[model samples]
Target: MAITRRHLLQGGAVAAMAPALGLNTNVSAIGTAHAQSAPDGLKWRHGVSTFGDIKYPADFKRYDYVNPDAPKGGVVRMFELGTFDNFNLVVDGLKGSLADGVRLISETLTTRSLDEPSTAYGLLAEAAAYPDDFSYVIYRLRAAARWHDGKPVTSDDVIYSFEVMKKNSPMYSTYYQHIVKAEQVGDREIKFTFDGPGNRELPSIAGELPVLPKHWWEGNDPQGRKRDVTATTLEIPLGSGPYRVKEFVASRSVVLERVPDYWGKDVPVSVGKNNFEQIRYEFFRDDTVGREAFKGDQLDWFTERSGKQWSTAYDFPAVSDKRVIKEKFVNSSSGGMQGYAFNLRRPLFADVRLRRAFNFAYDWETSDRLLSNGEYHRDNSYFDGIAEFMATGLPEGAELKILESLRDKVPAELFTTPYKNPVGGNDDAARNNLREATRLLKEAGFETRDRKLVDAAGQPVSVEFLSQAQGDERSILFYKPYLERLGITVNIRTVDSVQYQNRLRSFDFDIVTTVWGQSLSPGNEQRDFFGSESADRPGSRNIPGIKNPAVDALIERIIFAKDRADLVASCKALDRVLLWNAYVVPQFAGGFQRAARWDRFSRPEPLPKYGVSGFPTLWWWDTAKAAKTGGRS
Candidate 1:
């Protein structure tokens, strides 16, 4: 499935977004192997994992994190920041703003367990088989899976989805780049052949292929205009998931109704989820307006991103009287780097020393204290929340060995010194950090002339911080003075979301606040974040435009990791390299999911450790509570 605009609206962290659906289709067979039988050296299984650990067995019941018998009739009116002009998943991120929660209408071959670190169970696919080397993966589609139009999902739909998505979306293209071909070996089975072997993540990622309805995309609309999968359209596409588009208004709102006779409703993974009868997303220009809407009862749920607002904004009567709830959910996944990413495509940001100087000049301590009410922690590593994968102290053991192998290409300081951000809170500390930043800038061939920093050619050094959110503008304003003190002219350009995205896609900005969300088991996504190939790719997540061979090699190590330990060491090495190079000026992490919702919903106890408040998914309507709070049901 395409990267949803919701993720981008929430500060570009893809990790918190819902999983993309997967689909598979038929093609010419590579061999004579039957779908019932595994190929010579391959083994058929109900699910796939990053490592070899599979939590829920084949005959297991629904996921332990859900309420199996929970009531499910309610309307979830959520606020979506920014307008959406498109519902077409294929062209999302590249063409127009994607409608929020659009991914709910599609189902992948396999659905990842919210509780597991990196594991997926069959949803559309009944069973999957892969060889020891993982050169290819074969998925057997469930005959029971049916599109909303009462048509059975087939191998053709999956194949079409794979080819279309890989060709159109840069994110999907990079993600599925390894899968060289797709073939149908059985009536209901599809096979995905990878570029090579030894990449354990291929099988799992292949299962995440978003299936599309070929018949709908290839057919005509109500006015008889031919549907184009490559182009954006308002025509509602057919889906196989539990929810389908009920009604929508361009750039304003969209409502999805639960499929009454949903074919996959009885599936183990679907047992306790998709509780809302109608999921409505109302668009707003920004979160401030959205928060106001929530207060006025126009929105049912509100996810607070601003720490200051989270700390002080919800003193309204609803919260006071328990009609609304404010709670923090533990975030177990890695808090991947969210920072002011330097656009290396810009010649002005080419020097590592200058990037490091920018980091020194940032007074995160004071910023957190004043702007966020001291609610956030400064990000020290690319993988902050995850302890095992984070590079700390000095590299040793397996991580040392991995770094040693790339010593010639990486910064030598990484081996000798432990990476730490400059600390600043008091005036003296801030002054000291600014002095260090000035020294570093001077060393990078910049000179303070006429109270302005100038380069070798005497051109004044300046930077434009491009942002889409008011919160980001405020943060930039806070740091602008610090940069100005270093004799560097700072410009904060606050554009709308669309303009901001366009600037990011074209790498047209000097710096932008963005995020690279990380999964517990880091894999091919690393390539999109730091690999050389994605550095120049327009729509890729490599916002920093990193093109280091060392980073690329480390990404491969993480991808082809032989075991859990190997993966950890490889990730640590990559983290150390990124921190040492200073591709971004580290920002603050909330460390929790700050959310406020109407108190008419109830969730399963001890929610999945990794799910991070599975809102509206693991939750269901509570009639008694709804009646008390005057909530819709």
Candidate 2:
């Protein structure tokens, strides 16, 4: 799945707390449970969750994931996948890829802890509290919080940030849809009231909003021009984060420098993080060029996404001489689906049989072997893993109980058989699958005409597989023959990042290879992924343009889920429904961060459990290692 920071930023806003009611005990009674509860104030704890107790205590020192005294003096050069145009993340949204590490210029009220599943600690806000019903949440800003201009960060800034972003950014608007009002209630406190108290995730969602400096935009640039948050601009605005923009070459590179006297440097949450004194990001049009740059030492680090590349790409002199280090870091986190998504908006892919036929025509096993050296596994479920996100051995227990309500609406076959991808490791296996695909196409009002699949009106079935990466053409080419065998035309169109992103937002592609990042606890974001409302929204993650009532209902259940068991049941039911519909041709997925870097830095003893956020953020420059290898530091 496409695991962008945009996806990760949404993690903390949805509730992943302990269940007030026990598992299996709440599903039958959920129907009668009221959506809203009585109002009550909850004193601020160090962090928040759904069921389990907070990992950090009220007086905890710092997170265990980082080194409190890691020496930080190095220039860590990173690479961006595609080119970027706009530096504005809010207004540009889906139109531009935007500059990498842009979030360094802003701070959210609460930030996600890398090690935890669904928990957040205070950042700008020293304390955050909500009511039992979750009707409203209040945040008290830290007195020491100051903008780069040496001005105090205030409650007014918090309120203004919400109002502006909700109006300008479509993403923020959808994420903050449940929030009804934001106002300054006290000298340093801001209060946010919800549309109603019933939803359990409103408080956490409200905390995730990136607080913008009202004085910066509402006032003027150095030239005395009024600024608008919705307009894309190159002018660097004032920020209160740990770093500020040092220099930038439009669409090519952006460099950031640590603020030597930053106010929040010693804060508990900020300790041992943002260690690099100078961080740089250079842009490349594709991965091939980026890989070559890393090998030549033009770039400092590269993450190998292809299993085939990991197996064979690093046999260089630097690697053999031990000047470059290669390691596979374990990413023991929830995995989302990465597949060839069929656009439901297109009438050609609207039929379930037709979609299923497309899946049967392609051979994942052969593709996995040829393209990835058999290092990856064929992903079957939308939420694929050994975790709760995964659905194992069909629906049972609470999953069956939840799915029973939608028995009349979903596919009948789902009740009798577990979903599995069609097996095709060789020519004969592929032939059998295509024969079945041809039969299904015929049943779905399609027929072969001169060995080309034709519709009811005798028009040929053709689709363009839209992609941004130069590497994706190979994957598309791999499947093209299989599709051609079924009498369907496959057109591979590889565009630059900008045009590709615009195409995605406009719902212009027939088939696109996209990955949806799944969290251990699925919540509000599911609506943006599969809900009918988001199907038409421009920049929404609902890339397949799904508009099913069953999907919409299941997403609601997952969002307002009262307990862990209920969340699993809702997700499994949703996964089964999505799989039964055959929305996408499943692809391969791995649970590791395969990277190669010069041996000049060292990381904490153990990486974070939930993610591998990379070395630029937390790892420090190892002077001893640098001396041993004659590497840049």
- Residue lDDT tens for model 2, 89-207: 57645556667777787888887666655567788987777766768888778899999989999998999889987777756766777788999877887889998766776776687
- Each prediction's whole-model lDDT (CA): 0.82, 0.77
How far is 521's C-alpha from truth in model 1 (Å)? 0.8
Model 1, range 1-633, lDDT digits (tens) per residue?
Answer: 112223443433234322211211111111222335665546568867664445687777799888999887988898777777778888876776678778889889988777766567889998888876778999989999999999999999999999999999878888899998998888998999999988777877888888999998999999998888888777788899989999999878999999999999888888989998999989877788889999999898998888898988898999999999999987774457789999998888888999999999999999999989999999998887776778999999999999899999999999999999999998999999999998988998999999999998899999898877776678899999999998999998877766777787788899888777776667887888789999898878888899999999999898888877787799899999999999999998767878899888889999887688888788887889999998765
User: Which has the greatest TM-score?
Assistant: 1
What are the runs in model 2 whose C-alpha is more than 4 Å off?
A: 1-42
Assess candidate 1 and give its TM-score to the true structure.
0.95
TM-score of each: 0.95, 0.93
Error at 393, model 1, angstroms: 1.1
Clashes per prediction?
A: 11, 13
Give the number of the best model, judged by lDDT: 1
How does model 2 score by TM-score?
Answer: 0.93
